[model samples]
Target: MFALYITHPQVRIDPDVAVPKWGLSDIGSARARLAAESAWAGQLRRIISSNEVKAIETANILASASGVPVEIVEGMHENDRSATGFLPPPEFEMAADWFFAHPHDSFRGWERAIDAQTRIVSKVEAILAEHDPQAPIAFIGHGGVGTLLKCHIAGRPIARQGDQPAGGGNLFCFDLANRAISCDWTPMESWKGESRKG
Candidate 1:
């Protein structure tokens, strides 16, 4: 069996709304719906999601298709950026670069990249500890922490180079038994569950 880490797609950007509360944009929803119809989604026996609105929405779509309940797990959220609230794209990009470049340092009071990575990895490990290895599972979350988790699974140091493509809705799979990555980032809507066989 394989476990997939899937990032929520584009989100509705609302400067006044909390980042965790922001829901999916129309495009994001459409992409998620498309992913939900894929063979991969239907194969999921367990769907774990962050408490963030966008992640929950994406998880719900996949769960609906898979007939699996969405399990909202805390600490699976993106690296904490609440310190600076929301920054415009350009500024956010620069901050993100700094965040990744200095994994031990906090960017504008945001959670240190190293810390976030540890949290996500721990959360995932705890969940998998109790998961049925024979069943396929999907974890719905954001790019930052998802990249962190991916880096850990691949045995690479935390780096933004492993980050997903620009608009999200991407997924990467890992073997359930050994936790070895089976695939790299691929758009959720385009993945056909063809990489790793049971």
Candidate 2:
């Protein structure tokens, strides 16, 4: 069995809206629909999602095909960026770079990258601890913390090098029995449940 960590695709970015409340854009919803029809989505026995709207929307789309309920987990959110609210694209990218570069330090009052990594890893471990090894599961979340979790799984230090592709809607898989990474990031619609390398 395998456990997949999936990142939500593009979202409707509204400066006035709280980041956590942002929903999927049209493209994101379409991508989720495509992924929902994949073999991997059909094989999922459990679908866990972050409470964020975008994540929940992605999880629901994937779950619709399998009829599995989306389990919204509280602490599976993205690295807290509420401190700076919304930054323009270039500035946001720079801030993100700094966030990864200095994992132990906060970027403009944002949550420290190290702390976010710890939170995501702990949440994932707790979920896996109670999960059935015989069943396949999917966790839907954001890019930042998802990368953090990937770093922990790969036994590497946190770095932006491990982040998903620009558009998101990607996933990586790990073995359920040993929690070893079985696949690197792949577009969700194209994965087909195959496991390659970390």
Candidate 3:
């Protein structure tokens, strides 16, 4: 019995904005559609996503293609970085680095990496427990939290942190039972190739 953890790439919202809810960009939606058609077309028994808008948007596309309803899981959301949400990218990176250096105190306005990991892992474990052991599930989530969740599952201490995925770009799959990883990182150029205009 294994569950598949998949992330929505190119869904990064503007860190300097008060983005309470923003849908995925054009590339993000395309990646999700391709992901459904590629790795998880008929294999997934269920589709789940973080409660955030970008995640939901991505999940909806996957679910539509796969003929599964998207279930929202609030527990699997990205770390709460609402406190310093308006910082520019460079400042945000510095602050995030400081947060990794001080996890215990990282949740003043944002959730600590350790806390976020705990919540996400526990919820995922619970989902596994609730579902049929042999049924496979797919999850859509944000990049920063999704990558950290992988780090936690892999038992690697995150030396540097915040949304930086290793080699995989962002779209990935973690086999819960066998601990295998398969990443379908759509290259930035490839994403640009698929970009659509309104």
Report the number of the highest-lDDT candidate: 1
Compared with the true structure, model 1 gives a TM-score of: 0.98
Query: TM-score, each model?
Result: 0.98, 0.97, 0.78
Residue lDDT tens for model 3, 107-193: 457888778778887887788767765666777776666756677666777546434453222544445555555443333223321
Compared with the true structure, the alpha-carbon lDDT of candidate 2 equals 0.93
How do these models rank on TM-score, best leading?
A: 1, 2, 3
Instruction: Evaluate all candidate structures by whole-model CA lDDT and list the values in order.
Output: 0.94, 0.93, 0.64
lDDT of 1 by residue, 105-194 (tens): 998899999999999999999999999999999999999999999999999998999999999999999999989888899999998885
TM-score of 2: 0.97
User: Which one is best on TM-score?
Assistant: 1
In model 3, the Cα lDDT at residue 60 comes to 79
- Of 1 and 2, the candidate ahead on lDDT is 1
Tell how far residue 87 is off in model 3, in angstroms: 2.3
